[model samples]
Target chain A: MEKIIGFYPGCSLEGTAREYNESVFSLAKLFNIKLEPVPDWNCCGATAAHNISKKLSLSLPARILSQAETAGMKSLLVPCAACYNRLMVTQHELFENEELKSEVEEIMGMGLNSPIRVLNVIQFIQEYIYPGLQEKLSSPFGKKVACYYGCLLIRPHDVLNFDRTEDPQTMDEAMKMIGAESIDWPFKTECCGAGFSVSRTDLVAKLSGKIIKDACDRGAEAIIVACPMCHSNLDMRRNTIDRLLGYKTEIPVLYITQAIGLACGLSVKQTGIQRHIVRVDWQRLNSCLPEKMIKEEEDIHG
Target chain B: MYYALYLITLLSKYMAKEIYQNNAPHTLNNDLFHEIGISSARCYQCGKCSAGCPMAEDMNYTPNTVMRIIQAEDRQMDLELLSSESIWLCASCEMCISRCPMQIDIPKIMDYLRQKSLQERLQDKAANKSIIPFHQSFLDMIRYTGRSYEVGLVLDFKLRSKKIMQDVDLVPKMLSHGKLPFLPDGIKGKKNIQAIFKRTLRKK
Candidate 1:
């Protein structure tokens, strides 16, 4: 029997991070885990709600959790770090304050009767995939990559409480599991200007430019990330980042699932590698694959 | 002579209180505590928040300065802080709260201030004009479709901010990659989502 877990792909996964969605689902299929989408799920009210109304922020996530509870999911796999953070923080806030919780319940028109575990992509991998990852690996991803945790995944430590806030090692450990070297870099957990990606493109350029520069300076071939926002800021905003840096940097940003998928014998198309705006160099990644897998790739193509 | 000096001192103190009362309606510190249960009084001029802030360079006032201004508890300073662009510029990265010795929850305070700023129609005072419109556009998408629609959000933001063609080049690339879908995937619970928005964010 396959393990079943709730999956919340959030808005970005549908829109700008379609590759993330594909890679996540493909990895789940490979791991024999079934991802159940929360039925009729609404948005988690990302930064917009919290910035304007506290009640809306708590209520939006509360509704999502309520739906998950109704569906009898013990644990929810939120691939987007922003949604994961919002759900976790909302749970914590509701648990701490009965008045606010009831108020949110009234607004949501549902009761969050049971607590459901909200897991980010890193935690999801650590929980379900890491145990059997070694047995399934067909190729060792022999490359040095920077594991960028971004802001939401690690900070507000008391609420999410997944790993070390400043210097997170969970993604690094997961990278190491797949035979990749996680580099020691300063901007691993830095802010990528988050939702400001659209409004303040210049700010995203500056902040994301620093992260890309650091990864490149440390000789990282790719930057591994779990958040859609971080991926977009680093990958989609590459031209802006390059302009800000006064020189072009070619480090491709890969979702952690995509990196793990590659190691687990998934093809480039399977992991949606072609979706990236930065243009991931397949030749560079091909060199990192095991000799057997490389020969198999050539045989299939030839 | 001693009694006269003592009486004058007491009178001056009373007059000062009256003058302060006449000047400002309410202190920002008390309002923040009442609104969000976060107290700026705990912050003791620690610059750690500003030091760790990613956007401090572009902000009109740093996080520490905002906290200090809130602690001042004066009406003018509170209004100034609310209307200041610093509150709007906060990325809510939580770096300050994570590292602050006091654990002041500056992000929550920033949220509360942003709400107050919008309520008082002081958002125009924000120098970084595009931030609020982007947030509004994002919420508008969610309100209608029950999820964020990137193309709609971009169009709405462009219209609101009038800074069209800022990232016009990325749209074609995004469309080619199948990242930007022409139509939004609306949830079945669209009405419920609208209710959530209407109930929680009631119009002033």
Candidate 2:
């Protein structure tokens, strides 16, 4: 099947975490999937939107959907966690409240073409990309990687029905296909001190530290997450977290697409793997992988 | 359990004090009340934020205590512990936000309170002092790019704060491990990012 995915990266991918943006696009290309970037899409407003005016935050994305509706795109592949949540909220609102749908439609000047399936990059990879590439993966990640799904991904689960928002395993299942073992860590759905990271470092440190420490305690080499804000907190501030606790833990954090892309023969540059804070300790991480697989990869390259 | 008793005793004394001569927790960060934008307005006197808080055990005043202070007719002055380091303990777990019946963003309010206290130099922990440089770098990057460039932000935070030496050992370990990328992946339209930040910061 020629699957054409509509990609909406929110604001993070355009520049901030180019790694995530680059990897998703690369993975799409490598898998022979076509991605039509939604033009003129704005910030999803994240939880910040709801916290302010319920209408505006949601409308920010609804406006984009109105465009998608006109473009005749069947689904939107939102890679960012906050964007996924806002997009889902807009979808729910359009279905639940005709008045709201019409009001939003009137503002955006478009009629709903169809019910759009908003797939967090996880769903797209798990269902379409993973099954297709099971045989051709030249190298598996070959390490114990922890999956971090903060509240936005699955929480308010009624909205994001792709998986158990609280204990989302879509990413985990996707990882297995690429041949990396997934570790069960407790902070999977914990808040990485969201918007609080700005107004309150004292709180963000304690909260973020716990997540990193939990992953480290499980003997995991790195953590993978989907939210840009969560990525900023866990990966960017791990050092701050360590400093806060008087400890030294150097676990790298990668966006889920980047990690999965890795297992599927994606390179560091392709996955935006280098744009991380707690830098990857590839030596220790690679030690866990079977030597036979490494030799095969080198042989393939040589 | 102990928290309930503490709050009640405090409330009773607040009522008693009000009857004698009215005052509220004067030490409560006034700026926070305005920043959360509802510290005085929307809190329905519901105690759900404190109730569902996972880190409440570590706090002196539950989330409700501060709300009560803002609502109180008398000096709930003892509630100053919010600035002392108790409220700083909140995990941003958002159980407070998820459970609040009134949907008052208590965690956010608590967060602002933490920031206020820190800027006032009211913090008690050592780790927090180090975060100033991180915050400086983060905001500057955001101010410069309207978004953060990870590698640039990290290096700037370290060098600017002199915490570069603090993690000196990790540098070699990470470089040898194939983790370190010497050059940053600078974003295009650096000027646009700078413009957005300049505009946002000025407006804010």
Candidate 3:
């Protein structure tokens, strides 16, 4: 039986975070997990919709949920943290209030009282990738990594209800499975000043600078993230971050899927590693892995 | 529960006083509290929300102070808070709500306040000139397309701010990395999405 799941690669995936989208698709293929993009999915309305209009925010996610349910998708995987937050918050709201749910149903022009679960990237990996990880491991990703959750991945605990809102460690555990060591850091769940990346680069710089400085000071080779906005703040705005730090910091930010894909022996091109603003030298990365795979061809030739 | 009752009593007292003191009726505080589904009257001003806030230093009024401002029901103070850098600087991280002993959703209140501020055109001119326009352009992008069209959004914001040359150098880099595409792709059923926005507006 094919393990097919619905996928929602929100706006960021289509633009500004293509690497995240590519790496996720690559990893899914490697794991033989069939991912089906939800039919004609719209935006999750992220932080903008809620601030602009409450009805639009709720109705947007409600429409996505209703569409996913109609498409026969029981579980929808949203890789971007913002998308997951909006979808989960919507689900929490609609499920808790019957009257609001009916109102949303009327607005969306569709029924939305279905049991559809929205999973963040980490949760999706935990369920689908962890069990088969040992068999797929080609080399241990040996470098020390700082798992950055940023905000919205786990906050408003009652609504998200997935990991510990203050100190989430699921990403750490997931990295450990791939033979990568995740360090304990204060800014793991800190706000990276997302949504202000373009409008207020100075704030993003100061906040993302502190996060990068902490990770680098703790001897992390790379910072792992699940959110595209976090990546943009930490990766795209590197010049601003470096200016605030008063020095150039070369700590590469890798999407969790990219990190996992590399560990699973997917080529750098396949994993979209070169698309990052901060470059990752795969040869150096190969030397950094804990355990080197002894190729059957090498053994036979030798 | 007793705290809730006492707070309600206090609020009712204020409401009664306002009704008696003026001929013109205004449901300013009660309507907001109702819209957000939170009882600001229950806030005892513990300051936990302020302490947890990462951007509190940038805020002219701290999260805790905003709660007091809302509860006081003073028209001037309300306008001040609505136009203050505090609401504009809020990252909407939900730390205030998470740490609040009263379990108040301060972000929801902030959202309401931002909406009101924009509607009234009372946004802090110096600080929010860029911020308000950016948010409007973002919503406009979603309104036209089903999702955020990054190029269009950036263009809209730049045109509004008239700072087109600000990030010009970075465009090629972004394009090279396939981060920003030249054309915006519209999803199927864009009309349906427009209807959703329109219906939501009508409801409001």
lDDT of each model, Cα atoms only?
0.88, 0.66, 0.84
- CA lDDT, candidate 3, residue A97: 88
Point out the worst 10-residue segment of candidate 3 chain A by lDDT. Answer: A285-294
Best by DockQ: 1
**Candidate 3 residue A173 C-alpha distance from true site, Å:** 0.6
Q: What is candidate 2's lDDT per residue for B1-204, written digit by digit as tens?
A: 999999999999988988765444344444455444565556776676676565675566778876776565343453354344455555545566666667676656765555555545555453254444455565565444433444566678668656565545545644543444444333443453344333323332
Candidate order (lDDT) = 1, 3, 2
> What order do candidates take by TM-score, descending?
1, 3, 2
Give the poorly placed runs of model 1, Cα more than 4 Å off: A282-302, B1-25, B126-128
Residue A14 CA displacement from its true place in model 3, Å: 1.1
Candidate 1 lDDT by residue in tens digits, B10-35: 99999999998786556778777777
A153 Cα displacement, candidate 3 (Å): 1.0
Winning candidate number (TM-score): 1
* Best lDDT among the predictions, by candidate number: 1
Q: List the residue pairs that clash in candidate 3.
A: none
> Between 2 and 3, whose DockQ is larger?
3
Q: Indicate the TM-score of model 3.
A: 0.90
Cα distance off (Å), candidate 2, residue A173 = 2.2
Q: Which residue runs does candidate 2 get wrong by more than 4 Å?
A: A103-114, A284-302, B1-204
- Cα deviation at B7, candidate 1, in Å, is 32
Better of 1 and 3 by lDDT: 1
